[model samples]
Target: MNIHIIWDEANLPIIKSNLSNVIDVIDDTIAVSFDTWLFSSNGEFVIEFYHDGQTIIGLK
Candidate 1:
């Protein structure tokens, strides 16, 4: 499946400069919730969705 990433203008530049070639740019709603599962080297935690340029450093 193709993952669509919605980002704000401020973060767009950086994302574009960096991850644009990797991920697809999405302009629609980014859905997340307390039920959302996130895992990293640090640990696991619940997460929510935001569109203002947050760095995603873990599980896709």
Candidate 2:
């Protein structure tokens, strides 16, 4: 499994402290959108987000 995180740099401490429960941190933030991407053996996956948003995630 792969885990991805996109959040404000200022929250590094909080995020680091909760690595085991990172999803909770993202859930607590006020973000524009949250999404996921899945790829097949021959396919490519990508994650896109607006920089102005509070948090972004591309869980694959």
Maximum-TM-score candidate: 2
True lDDT of residue 4, candidate 1: 31
Error of 1 at 52 (Å): 3.3
Candidate 1 per-residue C-alpha lDDT over 8-43 given as tens digits, one digit per residue, 9 for 90 to 100: 344342111223333342223233221222223233
C-alpha TM-scores of all predictions: 0.19, 0.24
Give the Cα lDDT of each candidate. Answer: 0.31, 0.36
Q: How would you encode candidate 2's per-residue C-alpha lDDT over 1-60 as one tens digit per residue?
A: 233444345434322223335346544542523432222223233234444543333344
Misplaced by over 4 Å in model 2 are 13-46, 51-60
Q: In model 2, what lDDT does residue 14 have? A: 22
lDDT winner: 2
Q: Model 1: which residue pairs collide?
A: none
